[model samples]
Target: MKRYISIYSLLIVLMFGMVSCEDLFDQKPLDSTPAEDILTNEKDAEALLYGMYAYFGSEASYGRSLSTMLDIMTDASLASTGFSNQLGQMYAWKINPGTSEVGSLWGNHYGAIYNATFLINNLHTIEGDQDNLNRIKGEAYVGRALLHYNLVRLFAKAYDQATAATDLGIPYRLDYEDVTPSRSSVEEVYSNIVDDLEEALQLLPVNERYDEETFTLDFANGLMARVLLDMKDYDGVIDHTSRIINNPAFSLSSGQAFTDMWLKDSGLEIIWRVGYRITDANLVAPGYNFFNMNNVSSPLLPDYIPSDSWVNLFNSSDIRLSTYVATAATGYGWTSKLVIKYPTNPDFASQVLGMNMPKPMRLAEMYLMRAEAYAYTNNDEQAVADLDALLENRIENHQGVNISGDALKDLIADERKRELMFEGFYWFDLKRMGKGFTRVPQENTSTANDLSISADDYRWQWPIPTSEINGNTIIKQNDGY
Candidate 1:
């Protein structure tokens, strides 16, 4: 039988070649009629959009680098002593432009952005059902904005009111044709992100149109809350997150439902997720690396284990300890404690592969965002209420508490750590808060080693891939690379 994959896998053959790029940047994807012919057709237009989503889930994007690599790079998780040299380099804080990891990530995000811009540019000219056209166009806008948002946060300095206007942000590519673009100011890139997301809010259908895998109104708002949170716009964070929390369609998973959320094909709290099929051509290796916790003899056995400091943050009553951990007995012959957030599913045809889908935004994150916003704004009562409500789901007999000042703020921060540990939000959270971290070091000898990362370290801003530098003459490299 021919294996069926997500629409993204199929779209690679359908439209990727249509984009003619002499280098990573500076190319018209649809300069000729062949590309235009595809977009003019309704089904093909939607397929092109699906291609962007597929690229988003690729390892180069959220499937690995954004989620897995970033987790290992932080203090919350570590690379296995036997982890691959490529990943070891990333975890050791030795990231550079020449690393294949950075290059692939850069290509994946921009590739999605390129396709998204292509659709938004061409979709308007076609006459079709207004609502369907709006949804497609809206997805394109959100896709482009999302790619740029991730790029800017990783490549540029955290947004500073004093320096953002002058700081080197990533290029905001808005055109489909080949053009040499220079980095915009951090403020400019953020402004572009907000503009795109706000437009998405106007054009996108409500949560019902989400279909688990597609972007929706709530997703846009959740992302906006995240963007605002990173910008330290507390009121803005509250304003956006409230929209999702109040929505009737979403709520946190609790008890057996939460367990089912991970072990089965369910996403009770997901606002937007990336679709993944077991048969996806690129899915096998990453799925194996993250989900196959039962393999003890494998060299990758200890990868992505929760740090002692991170584990200590949780109380014994925390349900996540059991739900998220792979213990000595359950981890086959492996002895060290490990994370089983993406545990393998016995139900799948390939029982070894972790079949869980990647969720980019969820209701839990929105609640945390709102809680932090409240804490920062001195709304301690409201902040504690939000945290207690979320904790009620994760802890047994959880008694809610009310506190004020930094105590409330610290509680909110710890809540974020416990809630979003391996889903890829830790490093950014520290970066935004100006906090430093120390990696406890891997036990055995490997190319990777333990190191302390301070808030002001230049390494926090990832180097622009060397390949990108070699191809584009007008771009400038980040400092201390």
Candidate 2:
């Protein structure tokens, strides 16, 4: 009655002395060293860590499905006319335990957890530079926390103080053991996520700014802030977010710099991102979910477009409106406004179009999180200041606002939608806010199914994958399917 993950294969065992891939992201082993000789030195440990990063960059994970699926499931985006059926099931609210996207997301996230836990468990056995080893181990913990956090968010109910203690959560796997474990409570899963981040903060280097490609102290703190916000620990969110805000290394990107951050994947605000090299074999660009352009002259084929209501959320003078949304011909009969947040990076256009990096942690998010937390805590003045600061950077000729109470809170929520759209926060934001939405037909697009989902719908919690339930008898399926 143990949980099982089909991560380790004979080829992987022979090739990398750990989990090897058969169909998992079609990835190859980073090193061909025999399983028995793996983790014998510093290089081996780093190789294993790299394998975890590869999983992060896979289409099954952040590279595409994780973000795209969550977005399309919400009202913020709709399937375009003559759209490819990519994630159409999720967008239409027709997913079940047997859905392919569900199964892939479940398995891929667990695969990442396996890699992180393997690296964490074995890294200490290798003698290396103490500082470097600590940093690697720290990154592994952060990866584990991130993977589990995503799993719980997708598979379990949104964290509710009244019900989370009794609600089921995904297994918080800590080691690479072949033991079957039952799902933990939602509260327990969130607690473990925070614990992992705390460990990462201790081990990660204290620096002004770490490379955006690597996890650092700021990344750990930023993640903790997000986790705390989810748990409704407003004070805790303020404390962690303030740490990153005060640091001189990070600032909000504005004007042309902000536009380049999305198009070029270069900016001062990116705290950490899943980076991709043009030569990498598994390179599924995040933008491929939204639009595709073979060349500058080619017509854009957008699989999904922002909903009319969502498009209307941004003000005309807001920089995000111009930077993120663009109207283009779909190569079909109609033209539509496309989400260009992950547009092609000019540097890699010749090799791979739409190959922008996925920025999971950013400085902009901190201000939004802090503003929400402050509003909840009755710190109206500070909340408004945060809102003003963020708006000043995002809007052209933006004026400061003076507001408090529920009005300020409402503004913060809308601001989050405007600022973080398409980066995959819509559905989850709706869930945590205890709100439901209806997807109405857009003026130009009649393809929207007009789906209405309530806050109390069982579908809010995605069903545990059928394969997982069948493989691990001890596991319980989500209530709906």
Candidate 3:
């Protein structure tokens, strides 16, 4: 089992890669005065707060980096598409320790962190009404903590008790500094993230909604569940996820409502996600460099193709098959791209599927998290109850789908496999369970067999970006990478 060790070092390199060589803290003012000074009132604070969310919108956060990496590494079986190429060719991923992509992810996360730090530190100074101040600050804290958590997960491998104390985690950047910060151990990163969120969970009052369009208590709670789960604090995971699940305010949806989960300003299972209008200027041409969707098709790469077995795993009635794949004319004789997963075609950046935003936390994930935590805590009966709830919704004819014992756990994991496939949970799930590089090499297709993934690949633990080692004096490179 390959672990992405030394998450902090990898992050250091990746964070700096987001832009051209320059000061790490270079701030391109939206209108001139530094955000620190301008954000002195409700209106400015509101704008600045929303600006922090855009960090998630960056290709590194949800747009491409983490999301793409998550999908490619999991068993959703890549759609026979060109976009899948960068991921499928494990050899190709820059995260493959010491690659430019790894460097980019490092730089991107830190950049987001820098923006968050600025907002977080100055929230109080902004002259706003009690309601506005509390609301903006509450959301900022949670959002900030989450970015820290996200960085840790991608850079550090599982919290191995044996080595975590010494393992390098992503640098814990607390302020808006551009100096060389060395990596901390995995334990240090999680402890800091936990500390941040604990304070956040307290600071974020239950109210302060945004345009009926911002994060609320539900989002923070759901994120806390995720953070706990990543920490393997199964009991804590249960506490938060169960709250989100049992809350009458949130529930699963069907038909268009389900798809709307990804829509901008829409709320269903999603509690919080990134929001990128098709019109955002960040949209740029592909092939020309720096995160363009158009460049997506222009440069063809062969990635994960649905294996006969993996495809067969989905019930024929499962609508996701159509949602996740399309007939291809290129690699594997199928259109080599996941056209549907990025289900929306905005006039702005049509390439975005599931909207331009990434669902940072959602109710559906909470349900799954609770079920998994139940199983881990030996609450079999409760686990079954939670699992059935999810299955009933997705399965077409759920009347008699019998499952028991390991079979049941398999079903639940598979349910997650299908339900949460491309949303970015699969790879982490596989790695946590210690499944080695897996590949669905062949089967039932008429003339062509799709190669899913080859097992034993070490590309799992992203390596420390090369630049970080060269530029930062305090940073130490991961061992294996």
Candidate 4:
């Protein structure tokens, strides 16, 4: 069992660097040490910040495992036939407090939150140049908000304007605390997210140097666009994404440039990507969960593939079909179309398995968000303009056309699915829209029943982990769990 630390003790140990607390989720207790006695420098402070990123990249979080689990939760993909049975219940919508995925998700997200809290609470003490210190703090705040937003959406009910004040949201951990805290209201959680993002916007660099991998002005704006979109704030979505879309440094990539963007690290369209190195041992590269025979040789079988329903969503003329999907060309006939979105990082050695990076927010998503916002606000003219702008680069010799009303809305939603599938947005998108899914029937299994979930199904909200409820007395489990 891992040990826990009191809030006060952890903060002191963090700066002193006397404890082996590199991992954010480290449950081990640390010996009390004085910060003044330890060597506090910029490098030590930056190391802690990078550790937070490592936590997000862990298998339990954004790395291949979390992305794959979320994909299976939606209709876009499914757990491969031969993969672990632990996720079988998730794909089948049998989630409960006992579900390990629920527990893992809870743990990983909170772990990141705690890491951010430690940095934000104590980083000011580190002797660094004033500008660098403020930038680091801004990154911590934005990172905290990102983790909180993701946690709230999954653990709490969808953000309903009518019920947000009373709806149960995940604990908004912004400080170093060891006490079992109760869930906050959905409204409160979102408010905290916005406050942090706004602060990040002011402190972060408007134009970041190439060496900076931390969140910058563009990333903050893109994230707020996403959060506001979930909150049903269409006008706010446009406001933030416009800041990013109108920037000269970012734009939509077409043809080969778009294809290379996915395979390479940095690109014009990338707003911010969670990076990984080739030598990072046991790294849970999100791409590793997808098909890449060169790196992954296990069961010699792909763990997850695009469902027939998802495959049919793309058109032959659309560039995504070629860029995102590939033929398996081997045994394992669950689905013919394999995922290549996080294909291979060609810059790394072919033998490397964990080189694929996770792009959390990008320029393309901003355009799509802007289009959705326009569609929601009844600005169909501008809506269609944004849609066509994105599709022009996505499709070959795209003949631009205008669309409006319900037709325009449906097209925009479908376009989002095509543009953002397998990047961990499908399930969240469905939740925000209050839509459920029925998996496209598998051709290989005539006896198999297609999984169906209705819009009002209770399972739409995942159960809070049993361990948490047992430990935290003030915590109330979600209903019907």
Per-residue lDDT, model 3, residue 234, is 87
Put down candidate 1 lDDT per residue, 149-179, tens digits, no spaces: 9999899999888899999999998874446
**Order of all candidates by TM-score, from best down to worst?**
1, 2, 4, 3
lDDT of each: 0.75, 0.78, 0.58, 0.72
Q: What C-alpha lDDT does candidate 1 achieve relative to the native structure?
A: 0.75
Candidate 4 accuracy as lDDT: 0.72
lDDT of candidate 3 over 333-407, digit per residue (tens): 444323345544344343522344556566667778887787777777777888777766656666643556676
Using lDDT as the yardstick, the better of models 2 and 3 is 2
Best TM-score goes to which candidate?
Answer: 1
lDDT winner between 2 and 4, please give it. 2
Weakest ten-residue segment in model 4 by summed lDDT: 1-10
Question: In model 2, what are the clashing residue pairs, if there are any?
Answer: 2-180, 3-180, 17-35
**411-468 per-residue lDDT for model 2 (tens digits):** 9999989988767787889988899999887755545458899998888898988777
Error of 4 at 71 (Å): 1.8
Q: Count the backbone clashes (under 3 Å) in each candidate.
A: 1, 3, 30, 2
Please tell me which model should have the higher TM-score, number 2 or number 4: 2
> Candidate 3 or 4, higher lDDT?
4
Listed in order, each prediction's TM-score against the native is 0.92, 0.91, 0.80, 0.88
